[model samples]
Target: MRPEHLKVLIVDSDANVRELITGWLKADGFHAAAESSGEAAMRRLREEHTDCILAAINLPDMDILELLRQAKLLDPAIEVIMLTSNVADASTVQAMRLGAFDYIVPPLQRESVGLAALKFVKYRNLIDENANLKSGLEAYRKDGDILGRSPTFEQIRHLIADAAATDIPVLITGENGCGKERVARAIHAASSRCSLPMVMVSCSAIPEHRAERELFGSECGAPDGVPYPKRGRLEIAFGGTLFLDHVSALPARIQGELVQALQRQMFRRVGGTLELPVDCRIIAADSADLAALVRTGEFREDLYLLLGAVQIHIPPLRDRREDILLTAEYFLRRICAAMNKNIVDFSEPARQLMQQYHWPGNVRELENAVERAVVVTVSTYIQPMDLPPLQTDPATLPASLSLEELEKRHLLKVLPLMKWNIKKAAEVLGVERTTLYNKIRRYGITRPLRRPSGSVQVPQQ
Candidate 1:
């Protein structure tokens, strides 16, 4: 990585140390700026974009640990390395506890400092790449289309494209609110009969008494005792696509009728002897596994085979974590527009909370959350307090709550404001580095350590 591309902030009270380090860093092609005190370091941090911070353990009127905390609060992605000459064991442990990327005893090690700077640059690049991928995927979800960049979503898209060219029946399986209907619509829109009206029927919504008549239109009645003819959903859907949502909910008798319609494309209206032939594409969606239902005798094996000529399964949101942040941003923009709010973005804490929560209700749940936040947020930016409390059980702490819980409840809240690292966390808790480590070890608080995959994995309790 090019050092010039990586902005480094050097904070030290000693003028000679700051000048020596700044000159070396600039000579090495880095964009380095020096600050003589903790307060000056903070001002530089706010005024400039820093990729990494090289800070001393002590500065005038401020503690180095507290400075680290403040820097993190300003930008969590900014890498911080602590410098000290005393080489005290407590200081080393305290630096890490304050969330420093690495602790060094100076006279500085040039190789280590260079390597740490490169690591920060690489991490920033990975975050950019993830964001880019999400943007590309979102570009495909135009209008009412369900677009996904995740492998599972890409597979679904490919299947939909293949299924669209044919008139064969398609069975969409997924949990409720998984956008099964959207998939069905995409198929219809891409099909050869795109010009024809696409009809939707919820088998579960129709009453049992009306289901037969609804599927097959009623016949025209003669004078007093004769019945009138009415076209059913199957006949009305001729030359178009008939989307049967919740097809598994169809009555047994209606399932038999549907099978006959599929085979012959002809069905007689009630009270009428004349058979009407209709040509239409069939698409069925069910939340449950029809094969299992068939095995249990609730659904016919033959009917399952007929309807499931093509199957498309939509994955739940929990399985697509990569898309969550993008989707949240999308919803935020859309909801803010509709609500006439000027909300521009979510605070870091708010964004992190959204990413960590398990969205059990899928996209629908996210949509609701975004809408709620947009409505309740008073400022232009949505903060964590603006969002609904995550539905986490009090008795069962999150499995990977170490880094997140610590950052949310303690580190982030104290650091950036204090402009000092160790002193800040220490002052707040009334403890020193040794005392803090003992507490962190006792409480099992994990730091925001990076992994080889460039993903953050907080240790669960």
Candidate 2:
């Protein structure tokens, strides 16, 4: 917002007026350049950044209104203040409509002009800062998109690029928080369809009765007295990408219909006569095994074959332990910036603990942990105490331990530490609310009775 950092363009056909205004601006600490005609001023504008334009009502080469239009088109952020002797004329109204920042009369007051210029300087600085922040955010998102340099992670990137190179239907399978949707977006961004829409459909969130209507549009009045014609997600995503999340959860009827649509590259709207052609590339994701579901007759085999043309699996964090600290640092920077915290880095013990722990919830859990630590920590660095307790892997337990016993023990340990909050416990356990609820019922996990304050013991686990 400093005046010396701001550049002002003085445009006037009169030599005396141009020199006077330029001198006034420069004396006020702004970088000023004067041009006698509108054309010369526009040429200067194209070559460099101009924070404000002081244009006369009339120019020898072109009209002042035309110059203002061109300057605004070139950079709308640049402020334009009109200078005219006939301040009460209708032309002044036209100039204001054309996006003039302000109007100054013949008796140019230095104080008024300086104050206006200073306000515009502050406005320009804010615009520049917002633009820079947006650019920085975009770079950060792309840089931290898939954070791992491990061999498996590198292979995943190659597969993503290969998938992006073509329009083949993609099937991304991984655990809950392993970033299936992020991979889908990366493919869409890199593909030829980057300019088009990429619509996401959560298959598990829709009800069985409404699934058909949501994917395929319904008629205005064929089935009932409908108000208007509605476009479905498929139609909306034409010439782009359709991302189906938790595809395995799709109903059997919809699965069969979807397979037919995929094969024919077209589908008819529900209660409508028109056959809408499908122009979108399909990408499906699920944590469960689709082949296993097909074997159990829970999913359609044909749809599975159509979607699994090019399958990509995202490995869990435990399998790529070397990338733990790198990914953690990425999240740390992002969280600290968002929280406006000055925490520089994680303590050595915290870093060691993060590397040693198996992140069952994957990147999502790591993000949540870093955000929580940033919000809670008072010191300059994060410590192990700021993080949630590491969960014990059920797979790593002794072979003699029963599955029921392992579930009961994990529930008992995590529930107490989470203060018996089902939502938080579910996040730590990396399971859904219903899934956690079922486990709690099966294992008979419950909160212990409250004790007197003097004798209460907190569970360390």
Candidate 3:
């Protein structure tokens, strides 16, 4: 927004007019430059970053109208203000029709010309900022695209299409961090109400004391930060979807109240006694087993039946081992683009190890791991040493190995990854070189030497 940070271009066939405009811009603290003909001005535009261009109606080499068209083609953000001697000139209307931002009469005072240029520059910056925000939002929506080629994932996609065709209440069940919210969003985006907003209510995040007032509307003394009557999230999501995350965590009394309102398709405010219509579709998500809770008398059976009319379950990552490498590669590409890195892919061993490890935390853990690897990796490819030390499940290993034997086995696997580089291995282990040397001596660790006869020898580290 500072004047000195902006560059302005003044294009005029007459030397005197160019001097006047240049002096006006310079006096206003702008970094101003001048060009004699429209052709020269277009050349300068190509070589530098110009914020605004002031072009004369009469040009020596090119028509002013032609220059305006080319300037917009080159960069539409550059504000073009036409310089004319007559306010009623035919070219004035033509320039305005051709996307001229403003018209400046020749021989104007310094203040007039400077203020006009500054105003247009600030406006252009705001437009650019708004465009960037929209672009980022669009990218975010697309990045969460459902991404798996497994048969179960294919079934989920088909179920989503069926859910979108109607307004039936849906229940999404999954382990923690298994993309339940993502599935909910896909349902909303594909439904007829895709143009409407989708509001989410985190049932577990809201306190039990304030749950009722947050779901239904409240008069004056509402807990959601308003001194006057407040419309709850359910009302705000009128024609769209109301997503209930952790639905099983709602208090018992609130759950009962929700049942009556949902069945009758109406609700009332917390303090007031007037009935209001319920127009939003419901989509609930829970990581717990709601059916088991209902059987144990912990969850209401009627509420479960209403919410679980169309149940969709997401399997954990360990159950879908075939999709691990594909999903990891997807996360790698997205994370590298966000971090502005050119990391190509993972080493073959890293890929195998990632797929082999039991991902108890599911997709959330995978995304975090890929992001950490991208941060620490120095080369174009991610090496296994760059990844965090994975906690392997004991059941996957030999049953009789002691703690010392397991540690020694891990050291042997990690040393070969970095090619027996002591300092690199120590860095990955979060220990000093002296400690690594002591461990190597204590465990008698060595690198295997390859021989021409297809045999191997052990060389002590």
Candidate 4:
């Protein structure tokens, strides 16, 4: 907030007023420039990157409102303080609404001038500091531990940077276990609100009856002995971030209410009359197609539009097979350190098997596999037997195998792993139970029968 870091522009028709302000600014160690008319002020604004402007509202050659408008268009960051002799009420209000930094009256006090300048200088410094931090983050991300070498991942990294620079709501879409929440965290970490709390809510996990209460707090009952006030995620995420995972699963009633709240950036508690301001940035994530849901009337179109101001889609691990071993090694190191093991790396056979396998569960599955291997490894290097069995050999597969056949085969693998519990199987497959059931019907997959001899057999279709 040093004065030497600022460039102040002074505009007034009166030489005395201009000199008076210029002298004060110079004495405070700020670089100052004086202009006698609005025309000259406009010219200076266009040519220089002035941080602040102090202008007389009664400029003889040009309208003060027009000058303010033009100054803003030139540089939206320039803070303008209007000084007017005439006590016109409407013009003052209009100027304030037009983004003037401050309005001052006659007999400008030294303390007032100095204090106003200090406020704006501090604001400028904050802006510069955030820019510097974001720049450093962009550099670190290039070599950071997020773990990817594919072009899709590189584009996603750049998208994270662009989305973090603004306060816009972001909608992240991808298959489950593809790191949607991690991308949301990256946005928040690279933003100005990095130090603030990031409140996360799983839309699909919240019970329908309590959704409203969980999102917007309830007021305390005076004589009912019920808890009077309870803060919701909206209130808790103020001045920070709110991450809505599985947003497409939000109940219909809440979707409508959320649209209104998101539109105005404010909301009322479940039973309160007051409208509370929402100061948090919202980032929503879903594995399903939200647009398709909108077309089917399951999701509100208006809310989707608001949340999708910036959309980021993460590619599933199978699509980025090049990163399989890279990520596997990354997880291997961390898991080994945590488990206090001396495991250094995976053997060539294990590495080959992992690369050959199709990671239906994406990144989360890979991490779990590596953690499992680390727990059982008895030597410095992990062997193929330490990992889970590979799904199938690509060379052994029938040449006519279609995408649908492959999907059916994977679902069959997942169902048995979940012990034929449809709910758990659905979760592991990243699909709704109904969707999983439909796929089972289409593929004619059935649970295997258990024999008294402790053996299982798949029934004939």
Query: Which candidate's lDDT is highest?
Result: 4
Ranking of candidates on lDDT, top first: 4, 2, 3, 1
lDDT (tens digit, per residue) of candidate 4 on 247-305: 98789999999999988888998778899999998999999899999999999999999
Please list the residue runs of candidate 2 whose C-alpha ends up more than 4 Å from where it truly belongs after superposition.
1-36, 39-48, 51-144, 221-226, 391-396, 447-461
Better of 2 and 3 by TM-score: 2
Tell me the tens digit of each residue's lDDT in model 3 across 52-101.
88888888887778888899999987878887888688877888888888
Which residue segments of model 3 deviate by more than 4 Å?
Answer: 1-144, 222-226, 397-461
lDDT of 3: 0.82
Model 1, residue 399: distance off in Å is 11
Clashing pairs in 2: none
Tell me the RMSD of model 4 versus the true structure: 13.0
Q: List the residue pairs that clash in candidate 4.
A: 219-228, 220-228
Each candidate: what lDDT? 0.76, 0.83, 0.82, 0.84
Error of 1 at 266 (Å): 1.1
User: Of models 1 and 4, which has the larger lDDT?
Assistant: 4
Each prediction's TM-score against the native?
0.53, 0.71, 0.60, 0.62
On TM-score, the candidate that comes out on top is 2
Q: Note each model's CA RMSD in angstroms.
A: 29.4, 7.7, 12.6, 13.0
> Compared with the true structure, what per-residue lDDT tens digits does model 1 show for residues 1-461?
55678888888888887898788788888899988988988888898888888888878867877887788899988888778777566766787876778766655767766676667777778878878755643443343356567888878888888898889899999866667888988888777886687899988768788888888877666212445556789888899999998888899988998888778878888777898886889999987899999999999787899999999988877788887888788888888888888988989988888877766556766776677788888899988887756544323665666754743455343433334355444444332344445555555545554567655322322
Off by over 4 Å in 1: 1-144, 221-229, 393-461
